[model samples]
Target: MPKQPDPARRSERSRQAILDATRELVSEVGYAKVSIEAIAARAGVGKQTIYRWWRSKGAVVFDSFLALSDAGEGDLALPDTGDIEADLKAVMRATVAEFADPAFSAPIRALNMEIIGDPGLAAQYLEKLAGPLDEAKKARLRSAQQAGQIAPDADLDLALELLYAPLYQRWLLRSGPLTPEYADALVDLTLKALRPSARP
Candidate 1:
């Protein structure tokens, strides 16, 4: 008799297919129009199968984005080039580029919408995604503090908000073009605000 296929492997493939299909649909059609039924059809899985794995359309969509992040396959860490300013500039510019890319931006827009409406999904997003990424960035800021580059007493959380929030707002609102120059300016302005306080 032929050897049977591994059930665990088969299940993993199905799960990934579901996530890939979700990402594709969300990109092709805006998040508001995507349906679980459509995702099931695209993934070649039954609606019951998706339901068994995910509680709602939002949950599935969230996981699909999470899967993209998880593709990094290791603990998250920002670059440490000893110069906090340069490192931050590089990171911000990369973020701007991502927001400008349709492949990345589309799914990210979908994830943002899903999180906004579902409190539970929002919490999951914080715990699973944003919280960890924030911690990684904070680690760099903490290193800067030790180097006397940033005020030791600076609130790292606020420092991060100052650095990133405007870029995010502009992207979300389509208020302005996201460009390399814009990213650099945000970094310069935030670093000025975070500079070590002068001694009296």
Candidate 2:
């Protein structure tokens, strides 16, 4: 008879399976309807298996959240094309496409509604999702400063906000179509708005 799989490998497989199941269900049904029992059944594991690792359905949904946002496979890196306008357009263009992907938007919207209702989940999302993206924005702004494209003394944090906040508002609020043209408009507007203040 074949020997039983080792515990560590078994655990890792189970974890991946659970995460995958959560992603599939949340994509199709939104986070509102996905349950621990459904996830357990989809993953071919016991409900206890899920409960043993995650304290709540929200937590599992959160992991799946990351998976889908980050290309559902791995890192969602923003490119560094060295030219601020070109680079920002490249990144934001890709981000816009990803946002509109049928596979990604619904689950994220469900998560957003959850955040609206629960302050705790909002804080959790800020920590897990928003924080890193914020840092990356700052890093991109700093790069622009170094390239002499932005004022050397610019408040990079604010600069990052100016660059990202509008696009984010458009996406989260559905205020406009997140088209490539829209993203390019943002790139132009950002560079123009941040153009070095005139010296007296």
Candidate 3:
């Protein structure tokens, strides 16, 4: 008799297949046009399999994006180097590179537009995607504050906005190029603003 496959392995394979199918479909057809049926057919899985793991088409697409980011370079993590500025610049540069990738840009732009138009979807996106990244950055900022790299009273939330908003705005509006140099500049400006005051 043939040996049976491991259930956990089979489950992971199905999950990865669904995510891969979603990513390819989103890139080809855009997020709004991709459906659960299409993903199920593409992944060679039943519709029930997709529904078993994800609540909706949007959730699957978000997970696909997350998987892509993780496969690319574990995008959810921020460096915890003692040099806070260097750590932040590293993260920003990676973000700029991802934003510039055509495969990522198109689908992410579609998702952003979708979230903007739907409050419920926007909340979901924030919770699943942006919220984790925000928490990671805030944790890094708190670490820096404890180390005296940043002012103790600095608002980490606002600091995060200052660090990321310029690059995001440029990507969203096509107002300027999203480049490593731009990312570095943003990091420098933010660090300057957050740096602890010099003792007289």
Candidate 4:
């Protein structure tokens, strides 16, 4: 007897296809030029399929950004090598290199613009993407704190902002180069600020 296909598996495949199409269209034509009909055509699905899954083009684009960033894997943890400074420097340098890539930079910038313009989308982004990433980083910081590398009372959230805010600003404004040296410098400064004070 012939077996029937799993409807849920097929649906998931269609969902991934739509998200992939959204990413490609946005990268090729820019976010402002992408439309639901275009995404559907590119994905080999009907417009109704897209509409049924997403409330608007912005939502589809945001999901596409999430897909690209995560690669379908839910690995959000940062590396912890028992040397906080080294781990942080490695992560920051990788971030600088990623931002320097055109393929990554374009979609990331577009998604930032989309989030800035839409409050609802911004909230969703924070909750789904930024919040989880921040927590993972803070977990690393907490480990450092337990090891007495960082101040016991250090605010992990503030420490993270100190490390990353400047890099993000430079990238967003195109004001400075995103270089390994710059990333290392940021990590150095942040660590110095967060380091435990000398004891009596």
TM-score for each prediction?
0.76, 0.74, 0.86, 0.79
After TM-score superposition, what is the CA distance of residue 86 in candidate 1 from its true location, in Å? Answer: 0.7
Q: Give the residue spans of candidate 3 off by over 4 A.
A: 1-6, 27-33, 71-75
lDDT of 4 by residue, 1-45 (tens): 336568777888999999888988877787768989899998999
Query: Root-mean-square deviation of each candidate, in angstroms?
Result: 4.3, 4.4, 3.1, 3.7
Clashes of 2: 0
What are the Cα lDDT values of the candidates? Answer: 0.86, 0.78, 0.85, 0.86
What digit string (tens of lDDT, one per residue) describes model 3 on residues 1-200?
Answer: 43766877798899999998998887777766888999999999999999999899878887887776743345555778798988988888888999999877887887777778889888888887787778888988999999999999999999999988888889999999888999999999999999999999
lDDT of 2: 0.78
Candidate 1 lDDT (Cα, 0 to 1): 0.86
Residue 5 C-alpha lDDT in model 2? 60
Q: What is the lDDT of candidate 3?
A: 0.85
**Pairs of residues at least 3 apart in sequence or in different chains that clash in candidate 2:** none
Total backbone collisions, model 3: 0
Q: CA lDDT of 58 in candidate 2? A: 73
Report model 4's TM-score to 2 decimal places: 0.79
**In candidate 3, how many Å is residue 3 off?**
12
lDDT of 2 at 170: 80
What is the C-alpha lDDT profile of model 1 across 70-188, one tens digit per residue?
A: 32354568889899999999888888998888777877987687778979868877876678789999999999999999998999999999988998899889999999999999999
Better of 1 and 4 by TM-score: 4
